[model samples]
Target: MRSTSLLVLVGSGLLLLAGCAPATGDASAGTGEAAAAAALAEGEASAAAPSPEPTAGDAEQWCADADVSARVDAALASDTEGPHNGVLVSPEEMAELGEPEAAIADQRRAWEALTDDEVAFQQCLRVRQGQSPVDPVPGSGS
Candidate 1:
């Protein structure tokens, strides 16, 4: 009876091992499909190139067209905060307000995506508009 039990256990283990073995098949069977899928993905990625960065000239034009400085002055005179174009709530404040953590993360990511020149141009415009520049900048100190 003991030998029978041992034989059963060994046979079961062998069966399990066989079941876990890799199947015998042509490795290249799906290679064409995978290559085609990869090519399609690459094409899609290449076609989705990002828009060009906004130049400082573009920022200046936007500020001028929007009359941001005058609007900011009016907002300040009325002791009201204007709709800050690029500003968002701090993560701590967002948490206190019961906002989703993802919101904070998304805002931070967007800010971090800005180039240094873009940040400088934006700060320049903000200062002109009587709003405080995002001091220390995002993804940097403070």
Candidate 2:
């Protein structure tokens, strides 16, 4: 999907360039053959180019990135403002349920575990919004 979107973006740019190409006084004066040859050369160059190799740690990261994105999507789908649905609470009620420090601490740890993937996914979202894609969040490994 990401690749498809990028292709569309690039295709759009190419179309804009084609539209902006200068029109010769006599466009058919060898221009057509020259353009055809140029396109052929470009196609041959593209065909001969070597494909990119994934980095060393990419094998391990592939699954982690997908899993973290799935988890985050699920969490967001079920997002809520917590059980305390915005009602005034008395000082006594507040004191009754101190701060749930342990729960907060555990949640923080869980978030930390996924922070890098989360940042990378956020950049993916930015690209889907028509912004430039960014580098994946820096991980300890790479």
Predicted candidate 2 versus true structure: per-residue lDDT over 98-118, tens digit per residue: 324553344334334546555
lDDT of 1 by residue, 62-130 (tens): 355344545433433442222332223233323343435775576556557767545554554444433
lDDT (Cα atoms) of all candidates against the true structure: 0.35, 0.29
Off by over 4 Å in 1: 1-98
Q: RMSD in angstroms, all models?
A: 27.3, 23.2
- What lDDT would candidate 1 get against the real structure? 0.35
TM-score of every model versus the real structure: 0.33, 0.21
For this target, which candidate reaches the highest TM-score against the unseen true structure?
1
Error of 2 at 109 (Å): 31
